[model samples]
Target: PTMEDFLQPGNKQVAAGYVIYGSSTMLVYTTGRGVYGFTLDPSIGEFCLSHLNIVTPPDGAIYSINEGNYNHFPEGVKKYIEYCKQEDKPTKRPYSARYIGSLVSDFHRNLLKGGIFMYPPTASAPKGKLRLIYECNPIAFLAEQAGGIATDGKNRILDIQPESLHQRVPLYVGSKNMVQKLQEFL
Candidate 1:
């Protein structure tokens, strides 16, 4: 396909999935229906369905971000980080910080256990950093289908019109309520 053809928006994608290689190989995918996961069984030499109709929780007490960029982040993002560090019992204000530095791994954990993963625009790269097409879009599609949400602070990730094949965008994806709450800070 031509480069232009590859720049289509996320909605144009009929299917999206990722294979995470670790202690166990896993394949997760979606087709606007529901999210499913399969784990490769070495003995069987085949992928078997391990998770079915995956659904993300509406709220979470985990926050994932690279704190090294805290100083370079926008004031809103900084404020949000501070808010996440505060001690509040009823609402779980003091969220556990988890940053694995791998988007797919972090997102996969949150998709199942519930949490928020953030990569907002920084002072050095105000436009943000994650590739919109290959990285953000597919994950965003799965998040939405799995009863979660994905946005670049303001706009929904799936609704964004791709401007370039390598366009980068800020990402805030996770449990529905956590993501919506992050919007207030954005």
Candidate 2:
């Protein structure tokens, strides 16, 4: 039911994969660069990577989060969102919000474009929403490997240890500069 169940280091991975859920069902996976896409191929029973390393834009300007939980967020989180919102006018950056409700999807976007993805502790949930060991740690590893930064608002995610497997902690990952700014706010 959670990301921890999947993406384990020992688990088999298709290098890259994507699912399409409209009209017809399709599961596309790739073992390396040169992304490959595959349709159900009704006649066969297998997933194929037909698309190669599909070019993804590097200047990602979108963000993702559960805005409905905004009311329960800390002052630092609120301030960060406000800053993102102002990135266009006074800030002159022109960034936009794009929440997909899925950490993988959100992170995938960030992987493509150098944007920020935040899952900070809220007023109601003082700790955070994602698990430190399973979720944040692995994701942080991937993000950092892809030239991004992952932190617990103030410190690096990798620098923290999990007291429990399900332990939740604030997560702020993405562009190195953006992550650094978030730390400053914390």
Candidate 3:
């Protein structure tokens, strides 16, 4: 895909993000002034700016994973999803459930509201879903430049030099606070 596919005229898009569901799934995006994510809030009937800056909290209260694919995930991922699920219990803060089945939608929420969007390597697709040059690279540039963090759950997305145009990689993005924590887990 090209840059023009995501950029719209007079749409007032401060930032843009999206998920490409292929053999796996990927989330890619960009921003105009500051990075902004598009969150689908049925209550609002539109994708609003749920997160302003990509500052991760020291202890992120929410986590997102494709539970339907749980059987195909790695132990690390299973463990993490377990932690998110635990929030539903009485002891936790009742971390909310938000899986729009759309990468842009999910990342938009995490970027704006402060959380993490993970697309780690699963058993089916070991390299992950997102393409570095066409997808992650652009979004990573926008996110980090706008006070957010973009990574492969371990290293900075911008630092990962690409050898091909469609190189794929796992992606972990959002507020720096949460991003740092997720990095530790990886």
| lDDT winner | 1
TM-score of each: 0.97, 0.68, 0.65
**For every model in order, what is the number of clashing pairs?**
0, 12, 14
lDDT of 2 by residue, 1-186 (tens): 775554243123325445665555655444433433455655676655444444333345666778889888788778777777774654346567888888877876676666888898887778998987667776676566556778887777877755666778888888776677666766
Candidates in descending TM-score order: 1, 2, 3
Model 2 misplacement above 4 A: 1-59, 87-92
Candidate 1 global CA lDDT score: 0.93
Q: What is the C-alpha lDDT of each candidate?
A: 0.93, 0.67, 0.62
Alpha-carbon runs more than 4 Å astray in model 3: 1-33, 36-60, 87-94
lDDT of 1 by residue, 112-137 (tens): 99999999999888899999999999
Name the better of 1 and 2 by TM-score: 1
Per residue, candidate 3 scores C-alpha lDDT tens digits across 7-103 of: 3221323454565454434343456555444455556565565545444343445556667887887676666666655644453545565777666
